[model samples]
Target: MDLLHHFPHARQRPLRELLAEKQTWVNQDKKGFLRYRALLNELRHIRATWLDLNSDVVHIGRPSDLSPADRVHLQAALCSLKPWRKGPFSVFGIEIDAEWRSERKWNRLIPELPDLSGKIVADIGSNNGYYMFRMAFHHPTLVLGFEPYVHHYYTFNLLNSFAGLSNLQNTLLGIEHLSLFPESFDVIFCMGILYHRPSPIESLQALHVALKPGGSIIVESQAIPGEEPVALFPEHTYAKVPGTWFVPTATCLQHWMQRAGFHNIRCFCAHEMSSEEQRQTPWMEFESFQDFIDKDNPGLTIEGYPAPRRVFFAANKN
Candidate 1:
């Protein structure tokens, strides 16, 4: 008998919840889906708190002022998503700062990151050369960063010049241009950047060609954590806002990875955070989140902030 038949009620509630959630999410109007907007609201609130207290706290752009086109660009940046500045570490444009950390820091994810020394790696959509700077310092790898923004290119290059980080190279091209290359990299990172494009899957396919058959790619994305994802663009917000295809679940991420011809996929969440870290870090803006959740779901007690966010998925091109 099918294992699913053995436990008939196993997926019933989750399935029902997911279906209803999707329906409601799709029905949301203008401002944004109740769910995602809540996440943003809490983030904004936390950001305000952080800025008031922490003098050195880094902040990205505000979402409200974004044009529909810019919103899509922001989605691609995954720029709005968190884990923002990798804890204030720097040197030689390389992070010699003690705060710099690897996936190893987030024990909940069980990230199997390899030593970057001496391998050829591709940093797709390298915003501000954050990853490039880090890898340039510790891992002896030849890292190439592809970023389309001119200002970022200039700033990153200037930093590279000052730090004299020979291991890192910056380019002003989109991942779609990967077709120009015939060789493969030892590793490719597509972090927080795919959602902006009209074709995230196509971007994935482009990476497949850019990678060695067995090379791996790190995919970090913003997705609806519980139930199902709610679409913000289709419902409203702005006329030119591009839709963010939130994976909605770990399984959904696995599906996308599989379709991209990646193998041996792994996934994880941030919710497995330590208790103190969860409560102490004010970024877990629950009060503001509750307000938005309450607006869309008055009868429900869905506290949004601090909810598990953005899934981490990785797999090999093989």
Candidate 2:
């Protein structure tokens, strides 16, 4: 796909150069690229006949589209891309029960979501384009997803190839690339990404710059419980997940936004996560939420920190 065609405004901004750099990095390790290509080759021939992105499962095609042998091939192709983290998608009647029941999180934010008609939106850390596909139902002019992980980038590409959402696009990029898109988006969703950054304030500032004036940013992150304007800098990891730098209280998160110059900040939802929300499934057969928390004390992580609780906040660029 010619990604540059979608961003005419960004054509002169080194976007192409950046994409080239990313592609070089992806191919730098020839062995890894070949391994990834081998898995992707499995789904290159399969395509969905029809799709309904608005549904809970993000239905795609029908079971009858495939013969018995084709069905087996399709399932095997999907399994090769295991650890599906953010969807409950149904592709040609084959259900993918991913680790996270992402619809639950989407439901919590949908009520507060602004009308997306004719808007340009970005979804950071958009694993497998689950949220991007859902956002498409609102008829956004564009829904660009940034997922640097090779597995997710290809997973989205395969699904999009089948579903053929012209307005939905995935890029092998991450939050660090947002600077190239200054004032480019109408709405930005930065979910499950903040805490991973070592500098939350700087990350928010980058997000601030990426938005057009008055554009909204919806943020969702793992948070701790407290009214104090403080954050928990984990000694090593949180909930057994590494790269988690700081888990802030809801108020602290709001304060971070204020410092970053966002206006009309609202911390709307705060809910404790549970195994029911994110657990192991056939598609994602890895240790999950249940294993991350203490066996005896569910209120704390196995690392002895407060258990995982997620908070949603929305604010607009001033």
Candidate 3:
């Protein structure tokens, strides 16, 4: 409680304070936690009394997050960087936008994705191998990445080299060249590259070829969301101009999975944003995040994924 009270906010936190400042909600949570703790203890005692259970019940002190040596090192690091701003930016972009975000986000995708324990994985359209690296970092098993862009393939190779991830293997290939894979890998990450293909369904069929039966795919794509399909991702859809490709809503996405010889399928609505929110987001592909800093007028910035928000789908090959 003391540590939480003194914990610092590295970046601006507006919504957190606003929600907490409301006296009605604040009073409820404060009173609620105490009452809940008391109720839990009472329940425990009652159960113990009924069961005649007692081992001289003792209170165990919870361990601190930072050990004594870790605290010492942390203090030394803090002291060494006295003024703190060695580089241009003081806070990361994620930190700045943390309060504006909802709980449902892409950050959880990598962790909540199915376990790859004793499993091989494939990362399709593995641009610079971001999601693939996540699998390799967490599971440390064999991973294969298929990338079409030659420069991006080399960049992925370089990043893998620096990461020293020995189990990861990659080749310069697209969904079209998936015949190179002999129908293996337990899990596949298909993210940020789905809508780029002219026929998204065709790409899914190709991805299915690389995955073993019962293998799974965790997907995140630029979705065209509405009651009916429309031309939303036309201008900067990335693959082709006036792109005829369709980004299936959650319902349509499910239908496609069933048709693709996949089963036991489910989906997650990963990214969500309002029209007003979309305009505020910076474009990482164009320039560094710092280059687009409009701190004085955050609302004025115009540019980004236009049709409000997008969604991702997670499905299986079986």
Candidate 4:
């Protein structure tokens, strides 16, 4: 599929330029690209008879649609993309119970979501397009997902190929690329991405620049427990995740949005993370939240840091 064709005409030229630069970096690992190409080639042949995005488990096709041999082939193809991080998708009767029960998080945010009908939306760090697929039910004019990892980018493409959600599109891009989309989006979902950035405030600033006037940004992040407006700059890793940087208090996160020039900032939800929310599963059999936290004390991580908590906030551009 010509991914560029899905983008708006006004963005086509600059997006082309940006993708060309990205291609240069991608080309450095020709073998990995070849592997991804082979995977996509294998996936294109399998098509879903029907799909339902509105369900808790995003359902695609049914068992009756595929022969026994075809089901085996499909399962093998999906298993190749291991460590599924953000989903509980059922594709053609084969269940993919991913590491995170993403539906739980989705349910928390849905009540607070702005009406998305005909709006242009962006989901930053949209791993495997789980949220993007869910957002499709809202009848958005367009829902573009930005996920930089090649594994996830291809996974989303493969799923969409069968589900065929015309309004849902994805790109091999991350939050750093938000500058290319100045004032282009009506709503941006920046979930589970802020704490990963070394400079959280600057990342929020980029999100601010990407929104149209009066646009809203919904931010969900790993936060520390406290009422004080301060952040925990981890000396090393937080919850055994090395990429984590500043785990902020709920108040501190709101303050970050305020500093980023967002107005009417409101924190709608705040809750501690749990094994039930994220854990090892058949589809994602690896070290999970259970292994990261202290068995003796759930309130603290294995590294002795405050245990993981996720906080959700919504703010608007002036």
Who wins the TM-score comparison? 2
lDDT by residue for model 2 over 1-318, one digit each (tens)?
Answer: 665654555544588788888888877758767766665576566667888887778887789878788789778878888989989999899899999999999999988897799998999999899999899999998999999998899888878877878999888989988888888889999999999999999999989988988899999999998899999999888998889999999999999999999999998899999999899998888899999999999999999998979999999987
Local accuracy of candidate 1 as per-residue lDDT tens digits, 11-73: 445534543664465347745444334433333321111111111222222334445664454
User: What is the alpha-carbon lDDT for the whole of candidate 2?
Assistant: 0.88
Could you tell me which residue pairs clash in candidate 3? Answer: none
Candidate 1 vs 4: which has more lDDT: 4
CA deviation > 4 Å runs, candidate 3: 1-106, 228-244, 273-308
In terms of TM-score, which candidate is stronger, 2 or 3? 2
The count of backbone overlaps in candidate 3 is 0
Worst 10 residues of 4 by lDDT: 1-10
Tens-place lDDT digits, model 3, residues 262-290: 77776665454443322223212223223
Q: What TM-score does each of the candidates earn?
A: 0.55, 0.95, 0.54, 0.94
Q: Candidate 4 at residue 307, lDDT?
A: 92
Mark the regions of model 1 whose C-alpha exceeds 4 Å error after superposition: 1-110, 227-248, 270-308
Give the residue spans of candidate 4 off by over 4 A: 1-14, 23-29
Better of 2 and 4 by lDDT: 2
Highest-lDDT candidate: 2
TM-score of 1: 0.55
Q: What order do candidates take by TM-score, descending? A: 2, 4, 1, 3
What is the lDDT, from 0 to 100, of the residue 174 in candidate 4?
A: 94
